[model samples]
Target: MELDYVVGQTLAWLRALGIEKDTFVFFTSDNGAARVSDVPVPGGGSNGPFLCGKETTFEGGMREPAVTWWPEHIPAGTVSQQLGTVMDLFSTSLSVAGFSVPDDRLIDGLDLSPVLHNNTLINRPIFYYRGNGIMAVRVGLYKAHYWTWSNSWEEFNQGINFCPGQEVAGVTTHTQQEHTMQPLIFHLGWGPWEKYPISAVTTEYQDALSRITAVVEKHKKGLVPGVPQLNMCDMTWLS
Candidate 1:
């Protein structure tokens, strides 16, 4: 309710300034909810049908709804199923402002103007990273998990279960487990909840794995590691 009120006020202010139609507003959450407890619905937070929540590589943790508003430019009630990431926002904003993204450095974002304007579907691979490690990758309806893990067992011991009753025996775990030799592939078209993983012996699995492997290898070849920021802290100033 507070968020709704704030958004409403922002829109109302734009209208009062006679620039409502000229403004573009994009609203989205950074990640799935941090469901702290196992309480039933309406009591604890929910990440809908997806498994787990924030801090994990599951769809529930990574997937988020994106809402865009542009009164005259973007059509009303238009919906797009294209895969997009928050990084795309940087490129999209520049495109909306009639500017080109700088070419000097590696920009991982793609301009989403085509999708936003015409509702066009752009096929692209989305790589899910947990810190410096690549946890999963999704190309079209198939998602391959190279590493699967959720919150630590310590958290689960404390009665904090992100997945609740939806945990998969061999797939979801508290400790990081590698599936690089045989990635766990899921056809999200049939099961958005990721309840089932395609058998490794199936032709479908072989084909999808081939495609995903190529994309991942190419990405790694050109990747440049960035300096770690999470470990940097200065407490001497306070002392």
Candidate 2:
């Protein structure tokens, strides 16, 4: 209730300052809002429609909310599903303030001035490597999470085990769930991808899997090429 109250007070202040009209005030959430509000485990309500939230290398952990307000410049009640990144904020603000995006600095994010000024969309890929060897490659509307969480160095083929409901530490409200690269690749729209309900993978879906997996396999090898524990994690599959 404290943060909620602070949010209201902040809004009132902005409204009084008239910055509400000329400023772009953006509010969003990461790793999907907690389903259980605050608890730890696989029991929290998933932001589903996109699998596994927060920790798991699923879409639920990746896609986040984006809401902006700029009464003087941005049209009121405008909801654009334009893709952007939280990492782009600093550069976006600098560019909006008419500053340059320093080429010398290794800016990992892009400038989002286009999204605000020209109402353009961000067209780029975003990747996230999760605990264990699990990782995801997000490109526009298509996202591919590789379930390669491993247990050993020279033996990646043995691979990490897949279980949809495993327990995690620290973060409350997010519970573990089974994750298998095979199931995900074959049925991404379901399970870890959660875009589709069960029993709904069409022929077109199968074809898409073949196409995407081909690319993943090309970039991926069968063994861990780095330090075992530091490079990977133990998800009850291997430690």
Candidate 3:
């Protein structure tokens, strides 16, 4: 209700100022809902049919719906399945403002103007990173889990379970487990919830793995390590 009211008021203001057609509004979430146990509901929050919530590399943790609004420029009631990330906002805004993105540094974001304007599909792979480590990658309709870890156990010890009753064996784990040698591949088209993993002996598995491996190798070859920020801490209080 509050969100609806805020959006309504914002749009009303834009219309009042006669700038609604010129303004571009992009709505999205940083991550999936946090499902803790302290809330009034049995499960704190819902991530729909996806398994687990924020802090994991599962679909529930990262998959989010995005809404883009531009009066005459973007068609209304149109939906796009093109892959996009929050980072694209940077490039998209730059393109909209008649500015070019900096070319000196590596920019992982792609301009989403085509998708917004014509609902065109862009074929690109998305790499899911968790604290500087690549946990998963998705290309087209298939997703490969290179590493699997969930905080449900950690939260459960603290009286919460993010996954609740939807935990799948060998996919969700308490500790970080590497699947580099044999990544767990899932056809998101068939099961977006990631319940079924392709059998290693199957031809589909081989084809998917071959494509994923090539992308991963190319990514690693051009990767540049940055300073770690998550581990930084201040000890001034101890003095």
RMSD of each: 2.3, 9.3, 2.4
Q: Which candidate has the top score in lDDT?
A: 1
C-alpha lDDT score of every prediction, in listed order: 0.87, 0.54, 0.86
lDDT of 2 by residue, 1-239 (tens): 99779877888899998777656677777566333223454356556455445544555656787777666677667666576678888898788677898887456678887777677777655556664454555444555544433122222234322213332221111233333444333244234444332232666546655665555565465333554654335557553
| Model 3 lDDT per residue over 142-167, tens place | 99998998864666688766677777
For model 1, how many clashes? 0
Candidate 1 deviant stretches above 4 angstroms: 38-43, 229-231, 236-239
TM-score of each: 0.93, 0.61, 0.92
Model 3: per-residue Cα lDDT at residue 104: 96
Root-mean-square deviation of Cα positions for candidate 2 versus the true structure, in angstroms:
9.3
Better of 2 and 3 by lDDT: 3
Clashes of each: 0, 15, 0
Off by over 4 Å in 2: 34-42, 45-48, 131-134, 148-239
What TM-score does prediction 3 earn? Answer: 0.92
Ranking by lDDT: 1, 3, 2
Give the poorly placed runs of model 3, Cα more than 4 Å off.
39-41, 152-154, 227-231, 234-239
